[model samples]
Target: MAKVKSLDDLKKIKEEFLSKEELQKNGDKSLGIVQIKVAMATCGIASGAKKTMDYLINELDNRAIDAVVTQTGCMGYCYAEPTIEVTLPGKEPVVFGYVDEKRAGDIIEKYIQGGELVGDVIPVNYETIEEHNIE
Candidate 1:
């Protein structure tokens, strides 16, 4: 591989890389896919969350899974940078922390495919709960 000389070269290199990565993405066009959310707060960015988020987007696109990848504000998980939330269609979103390539892969395979929970989880909470137990 040669060094990127210009913007055009960089674009070409990226395209090639995406093409190569897409070959391994087998869940293309699979229905009932899950959506992914990566925290992109100031803390997350400082902890290399941007790169992980980009990697996830690329990987998802390569696999051709129709997933929505977006960012969220601080989830109070600054210690676990590069955190992500995977939302399956019928289930609530499951938050994964300290995510990297390996965890992302595991998420795609185990959680997404198997419908099982991963190691780390960030519970979804609301600011307040309404009392619905009226008799």
Candidate 2:
């Protein structure tokens, strides 16, 4: 870490740290924004989820898209390692598998930006507890 030389520098460092902390927390849920969760478990990492995530972060920022890219644990789709879950505001979340850098770009361009569905969609097989009213 670089030493802060002045108050302005300290503020900049704090802002940067807060930004990274927000990404790690994955709690950005502002309405009307896209939310992306990249699976980063052991299998996911081995399959290059880190690269995929970096691509997503960079592409989204480059395109000036309003999106939150965050890391998540295993999505239980080990067969489809490097998976990602995308949630458009006011829409249900969609899970896509086998994501690479190219595919990540496509996802941002087509799905996130253009509001179109792309390939490699993994169907949601399990129901949430809310669906079953198991409270």
Candidate 3:
């Protein structure tokens, strides 16, 4: 890391960081942004969810993609730890399991950027009451 010796350098760094923060904050359906949820439960951490989350955050920013990367608790998929749910604007969320850094990168490139589906998605079998039209 270079030393911040001048105000100009500090301002440049601040600008870059602020832009990323703005993108993360704007990660909502109204903004047509992508929302990413990383499972951070004990099982997930034991399976390397932190690394996967870091990789996604950095990669998303580098790609200049408008997205929010948030850490979440257990997703009830302990069998397949390190799970991530990606929700694109106006679309149902897709959950992927066993995601390492490489898989995370592939997801960002293919699914998020190119709008194509990637392999390794975990099937969501159950549905909420809303889906059954039961109030």
Query: Which model scores highest in lDDT?
Result: 3
Ranking by TM-score: 2, 3, 1
* lDDT: worst 10-residue window of model 1: 21-30
Arranged by lDDT, best first: 3, 2, 1
Which residue pairs show backbone clashes in model 2? Answer: none
lDDT of 3 by residue, 6-109 (tens): 99999999999988755544446457778899999898999999999999999999988878799999999988788999988767789998899998999999
Clashing pairs in 3: none
Q: Which stretches of candidate 1 lie over 4 Å from their true place?
A: 1-33, 125-135
lDDT of 2 by residue, 40-90 (tens): 989999999999999998888888877778899999999887899998866
Q: Report lDDT (CA) for all predictions.
A: 0.76, 0.86, 0.87
91 Cα displacement, candidate 2 (Å): 0.9
Q: Per-candidate TM vs. native?
A: 0.66, 0.74, 0.73
What's the lDDT for candidate 3? 0.87
Please tell me which predicted candidate would have the highest TM-score against the true structure. 2
Q: Cα miss at 74, model 1 (Å)?
A: 1.0
